[model samples]
Target chain A: MPAHIKNWSRDDLLLVAIDEGSSVSATFTQNTFCAAPVTVAKEHIASGSVRALLVNAGNANAATGERGIADARACCRAVAASLGIESSEVLPFSTGVIGEHLPLQRLLDAIPQAADRLCSNGWGQAAKAIMTTDTAPKTATRELEVAGERVRIVGIAKGAGMIQPNMATMLAYVATDAAIEQSLLNDWVQEAVAASFNRISVDGDTSTNDACVLIATGASAPPSANPQDDDYARLKAAIIAVHIELAQAIVRDGEGATKFVTVQVTGAASSEEALKVAFEVGESPLVKTALYASDPNWGRLVMAVGNAGIEGLDTGGVNIYLDDVQVVEAGGRAAGYREELGEAVFSKPEFTITVDLGRGDSREHIWTCDFSHDYVTINAEYRT
Target chain B: MPAHIKNWSRDDLLLVAIDEGSSVSATFTQNTFCAAPVTVAKEHIASGSVRALLVNAGNANAATGERGIADARACCRAVAASLGIESSEVLPFSTGVIGEHLPLQRLLDAIPQAADRLCSNGWGQAAKAIMTTDTAPKTATRELEVAGERVRIVGIAKGAGMIQPNMATMLAYVATDAAIEQSLLNDWVQEAVAASFNRISVDGDTSTNDACVLIATGASAPPSANPQDDDYARLKAAIIAVHIELAQAIVRDGEGATKFVTVQVTGAASSEEALKVAFEVGESPLVKTALYASDPNWGRLVMAVGNAGIEGLDTGGVNIYLDDVQVVEAGGRAAGYREELGEAVFSKPEFTITVDLGRGDSREHIWTCDFSHDYVTINAEYRT
Candidate 1:
């Protein structure tokens, strides 16, 4: 029942529907030039209850002006007509090439068949169908007991590049069988995403069609509406765990990524400064290239730390570590640091670069991937 | 008579001397972890009249502690001993690998030899000697008439990577024969640098060894100490022209650079905002890679614009142009745009990306180069 919405040989369309009275919380891209589908989805998600989501890959319905909005609405209308729901009850999502319009007729004709073929076991297939540049599908699941009942949370995301998510990822659908209040779900989604998707960057680019949805189906749970309840805490932990897994998976499968890098900043004067230092190190092209080459180029690390624009940052007080190997101490090459030790650590596929600002106790960390030659090949040759 | 300083196979030391009354102005890196030579040079230049400059390649005495300051002073002392000038009259510069100590003995031994070999024709050789990863030497010259006297301005610079100078460039020395006052020369140097060195970026990394010095030897007649004189204007224009030429040459010879790009941001609410948008688009890895592949990826362009974080930026008013072809209009694909047109423009080795913010009347432009596989190869394999 999957349809080739963009006329590609592969299926590029997906549809997800939930039961009535389900609570949903979603976040969209902070990009001011968000896609048409994002515009439509934001409006529909505001209605408090949504029944379905229509996602199409290959042609991101972004920068298409009024016609793109109309196209998104038409697709939502077709999905609604087949599912016996109002158009506003459906949220729309699109990802892929930006600045292109959707093939309305192909999508319209396939909505009915997609609706008829919808099943609970289609989560795995849905993950594959939503991919654009992702080499593999990203999906995670968590199970917990809430109020003596089984609760399940499943999440699927698709993003390989243009991945520095501001508010959310390119496209993610997280559904939990546990019942939760709308307000709690909203707060949980924001917190979960902030600590997960927001802490990763592939190329430091924020996409125009990023969206993350959290759904509470209320199909198998003792509904708990109180924020102070133990059930709320349990469910929140489970959801955040799933989100983190998905976020890490995205980084692991990042486009042309050869290594997974964790940049941790400590001893900053403030949490904001720590995060700034961490991201400055994580997203630095020089640092990422060195990671790809498996080179222990600690000079670039110290340079990135200085470039973080920290006010009154005492260079004499900074220290950097490559995993357990102390590479830089007091802003210079550590006396005990050996080239072979640093090289051994950088040769790994995963490593952490810890920077102590020697300012205060604040700390933050972010995950990133190395810049590889294939990164150029994938992005440059990508027709989209 | 050039001598090896860092013990490289080739000569790595350079010396330049001027008359006793020469007026000198200089700018250093904004990086908090600036090199030891930068600190030493700051102190020396504060004495108002510098007689000589000592430059060494193959090692940046950066990230060194108090030892680096002592080493820099020792080198200055050697230069001053050979030239019979005070130690404070000699400015020192080091550029190459970061976080390494200088070979103080070799540098000291080379100072007398380098001073003995200093000549008017050493500019070209000095340009080549200062190079690290640069494929070619960067040198520019301009001649103009000031008060019916011919004045010559010549500059030499060396930087292939670790660019994005905040206040100055990575090692540039410009000398003019026209006489100018210290304060006027200082103001001219700042204005000239802001328009030249500060307007270009190769890797968006500000080096800790960045230094640019402007020297007026007071050798020619008609010493114009007044900023309002016609001679001052003529000399200033020539000096700025030479600075622009050297800056562009650095970008043209950027490490692994294949295409030269200019990003122009216009119609912003302020020059600062316009510059921010220009640098954001110019330095975006996605945009640079697309330029490398000759792919007309306007989607990435808009994404970069949105990522510039201009508060309340009206996307509908944004427009982007690839050379003469308007790729984006009103925040969307222009109605008259064609894929082939964009491809044609991108395939060129030199082109401009013009972003019209449509906000106010401010505008700014910057020069950059494409990020290619060689960029990764060069930086990743750099031993330093």
Candidate 2:
């Protein structure tokens, strides 16, 4: 991530500086066994005017009890002191092994160096520093004309499994140089995440340290705050577009994953049911492995939908398709569908599965990666 | 699995006939998309007298719409006609591929042969006939003395993945010659299954065709039906023991499995919470793969427990052990615990993970298997 830092080193850390008077909105994981840094970040974000994000990698500082929280606060204080800012204004983030305390002294020593190295170019390193089992750093950028002003939005995220809606075990940061209200920023962060990071699965194991933060420097001006305004719509679209790209990148580079899949479930009775069906297909080990092997095993999709525990689900009204190949229609193998056609579509690295429950007008979609042997190799042999 | 009938054949079918007036009790998958045969079996079992079980493997008559139900009825009628019994006295079971109808003529032709081959010593063959991706046929036997009358119990089950509680995508048959009332037989079947077939998992997917049936031929006399009666208790204990053993055998031979694991969650606020914890650990891909590699990655267990969605879970009150080696104490690494010790325990073919939530008296446990490369290979490459 950092040229000066060892690529294989586990003691990775990053610092993100916010311009003076900048507004910040953040979302923290709701898991009870949250990392100490998550607890610290939540408190600091609540302080209203967060100055920076001080992140450390290698040890999650989770389940270390009270001492872990103390260490997290200490790291924040170190960063805050160096920046001449209040300790409560600094948010801390950590990823990597859980249940280990922070190397407090070593971390404190690095804060000054991390701050000294901070620059606009640091975005690349920042993304790389957050990775645990991830193979590559993920970053996305979008430029939109807001109120005739050049507005730039950049987003970065790191995740490799231990992912499932409810914020997925990931750390994401998005910063926009556009003037926006803090309350609106929080709402937009929630909205963007719901359509992006929140709709992806790598093994359906939600981590205990997921956090996403959005910062607006207010360096560039936007036209309006009204929802129906074209300028507001453009800004929101650009932010979500960048977030989706960053989110999709995580699924593409998922641990041990070789195929990127999208599960789209529509015509369900409700959004929740549709989401359940989409996630059921996306997160199913059977379905993921089939995609890994490029095997057109459509039956597993049926099994997953059935197991979604949806009340009064009518199998007879369900239809499934693998890309353009109609594999299952009206709850059975499509009349004209051949095994070879199904195989042809599945052999691709990217494909979409469409499931129509034929009940109502609800829909949901989720991105996922296949369960491959290399994923087992990376996760099983690697300590992350 | 039956020779002279292809082993690689997906068209799996079996029939077990009892001497007459046999009392039958059964459990089916609670998954909404129950197969046609499961629907038929439930109705026939309700008829109060089940003389035979007509099971088909390979083509699971599921999601085939109304035609699937008709095929199941046709199968039952064929078996009944050949056995010279009422069609309502037959319970049908189907396993293997979903959304495919049985080759009606071929299956009907085989029913006569299956009935002809039905003998007192066909328990082994019956077990073998029900296998899908299972590496080996699973069977267990129990002999007990009730009211001075010797009773024999034989149980057989076949499952690998798509295995979850209630009752898992499996076909298990347990037959006993002990005299018991039909009503008590149903009650005992539910109780025994709850503790046996319902406490093991190979994967979290619940199949649409899971069925477990218990047969009491009333050939030998057991005393009374009351729970206080020693004879009834003895008979119930013997049946459950065999059922559990059969269930465990399935896990031991889990698809791509190299290690058998027992996850025991204790001290939860409620039994449901404990079960949620146990299943979370058992079904976690990270935990299973770590066990597959014999790696002492206890953090995955922490991640799983934290993500179990348990309300107000206290990490500080948690303790974990790998077999006799305590890895976690009060939610952190034990003072005397070493990675090598955990490695030694995990390297074994079988081990137990004891998680003490340290909050309440409720407890639950489940049997599981490690996820391995072979599991991915078998599930991905093999045709279901």
**Tens-digit lDDT track of model 1 for A1-384:** 457765577778898988997889999998877889999999998876799999988888888888899999999999999999999999999998887778888899999999988999888999999999999999999888888888889999999898885876678889998988788888989998998899999988888899889999889957664678877777888899888888888999888998998999999999999999998899888888999989888878887888888999999999999999999998889999999999999999999999999989999998999999889888878874
lDDT digits (tens) for residues B74-142 of candidate 2: 988998899999999888888888777678888777788777777778778777778878888899999
RMSD to true structure for each model, in Å: 1.6, 2.0
Best by lDDT: 1
DockQ scores of all models, one per candidate: 0.73, 0.72
**Chain B, per-candidate TM-score:** 0.97, 0.95
Q: Candidate 2 regions off by >4 Å?
A: A1-11, A222-224, B1-12
Docking class of 1: medium
- The superposed Cα distance between candidate 2 and the true structure at residue A83, in angstroms, equals 0.9
lDDT of 2: 0.84
